[model samples]
Target: MNAVGVIVEYNPFHNGHAFHLHVAKEQANADIVIAAMSGNFLQRGEPALVSKWKRTEMALKAGADIVFELPYIFATQQADSFASGAVSILEAAGCNSLCFGSESGNIDSFYQTIGFLKNNNELFQQKVKYHIAQGNSYPRATALAFHDLTPNEDMLDLSKPNNILGYQYILSVQKQQASINVFTVSRKNADYHDAYFSSETIASATSIRKALFSENGDIFSVRQYMPETSYNSLLEYKEEYGHFHDWEQYFPLLKFRLVQTTPAQLKNIYEVEEGLENRLISTALESYTFKQFMEKLKTKRYTWTRLQRACVHILTNTTKNEMDRKVEKASYLRLLGMTTKGRVYLNKHKSQLSLPLISKLSLQQNEQIMLDIRASRIYALGTRKNQQRLLEMEFKQPPLILN
Candidate 1:
């Protein structure tokens, strides 16, 4: 049996996601679909709208056969590292292909861009350093350097979010010299950042999340945009938990963490560089809200998104040394949930898996698992429930099995 892989957040499984899952499986002609999903924190440096377990349940109900947890270390980083970690896990799981949604739906362009970067690596590195020295953010600097080197308008589409991540996925596979066939599903209807609901059947995750948390959010209105099964699951979860988390709820804890850390200590945190710690410390002290602190810290050199991720690292005490250790030690595939078919797929491939597959809580608290637990605790802080009970859910929850 063959399986196709996807790296997803599902943040809250909606119609667009179900469409993509349908296309991925059909295009690959695979027997099963495996998803490597983000944990409590997403790539955007905010807590997921729903817990990973809830998201997993949604994915399985929608179409996915299995869900694997993408460790917090990689899930919170920028596109390249995030893709590398996700692809590594999928490859280790013995997937035959990788499928993802893209804005341009052009696979050849991604390959061309990757080839260009590899061939001009030395020059590209020099250009990136020069642009950074000139006070441009890393992402912007890289885009500027690409423009200078290739001057192709089409190639520059790599700057778009989905396309950028798609490029990274292919690049990561090449770096590992793995033979995973790649497929791109053209994105439909809503754009990635679209925050308004335009229809009932198709909308961006952003739009769904915005509506779900808005003051006027009504279940009847929100239900129209999601599959019936997904909508029901979300509705059940909301009724029990009140609502999903918003980033604002985590502000107090983040502020407290920032207040206690000195500049010297903050300097050693992962992704903290070029005196960013000073800015974080000073701004955090002066600003009371997460919004105010982010506004004060945002600049041409440091994007708001980057600053938000930095705050997450500090709140969880994730330092550069620790990040490196975790990255090096990410050798196990942690299972989150699976469908009946997914279980069969895994059992068939068990002997061929390159990494140890973890399906239950362990007695040993390793560095990587510890960081994930810490991230979960921080995410739980955003909820109104008892903190200890929320933490206990991490240990008590078993892999979701969908018949």
Candidate 2:
């Protein structure tokens, strides 16, 4: 079967995402659509308002043929690593193409930019260093350098999340020499970070998340935009728990873990560079809330989300060495959900797969997997029921269809 791949967070599967999936299938003439999705934590360094399993189900019901977990280590990382991890997983799963939403929506321009950057690596590096020396943040510096090289004013607006991730996706595909065809669908209506929602067919996931956290927890407000399966899942989760919001309840445990760990140990955590460990250790002890601690550590060089992710990595004991070791391309596909056609394709290609396909959550001995397991346990500290459920989480059977 011909398949197209998507790398997504689907923090809460919304109408815009549904549109993208439909376009991906139509544009690629694909028989199957696979997604490499973030788990409980998202790239923005926040816990998902709803569970990953529910999101996977929503994706499957919304037209995705298969869904695979993107893993904790990669999910909470920067753009480059996140794209690399997601793309690597999709390639391993036998996908022949990839489709993503882009603000520019001009594949020719994207290719031109990628080609320019590839050919002028030394000049670009020098220009970036020059900008950084002027005290600009890394993103700003890199954007300035890129603009200087290509004189493309539009690409300089790397502040947008999708644009930044899209560039990284192109870069990864080029570097890996992957044969997967690339395609983009123009981003619709709401901006990625915009918290406002409209009655239009396209709505940002951010807006949906905000609505979910509102006092009434009104699913009806955004019900029209979400897939029926996703809306039902949200309602079900809310009915089970008072509200499907608030990750702050886990902050106390996070703080306790931060305080208990030594500075030397904190030094080992991913992104804990250049004495940031000492700052984190000191601030974590004095600040009463996670937000306050993060605020205290925030700088132009280190973004709020980056700092938050670093703290999470520290709390979860994801060391720099551990991240470096797992930096190699993904070696396995951990299936989360799939349709009948997806299962058939997998059955046909299973033995021909270059990487292992994982469906069972057996005890893994690798350091990275062990750390992820421990982090999953820690992530459950917010609620008693969740704690029990997490500990007993089983490897779901294949073809776990939503409907």
| Best of the candidates, TM-score | 1
The digit string of per-residue lDDT tens for model 1 on 176-266 reads 8777999898888887888997765888889888887778977677787788888888877776666778767888888888789888998
In model 2, pairs of residues that clash are none
Give the TM-score of each candidate.
0.95, 0.92
lDDT of each: 0.85, 0.78
Deviating ranges (above 4 Å) for candidate 1: 153-156, 325-329, 363-365
Q: Write the per-residue lDDT of candidate 2 for residues 163-253, one digit (tens) a residue.
A: 7888889888877878889988888887888787765666888888777767775779888878888889888776654456444666787
Model 1 scores a TM of 0.95
Candidate 1, residue 86: lDDT: 93
- Tell me the lDDT of candidate 2: 0.78
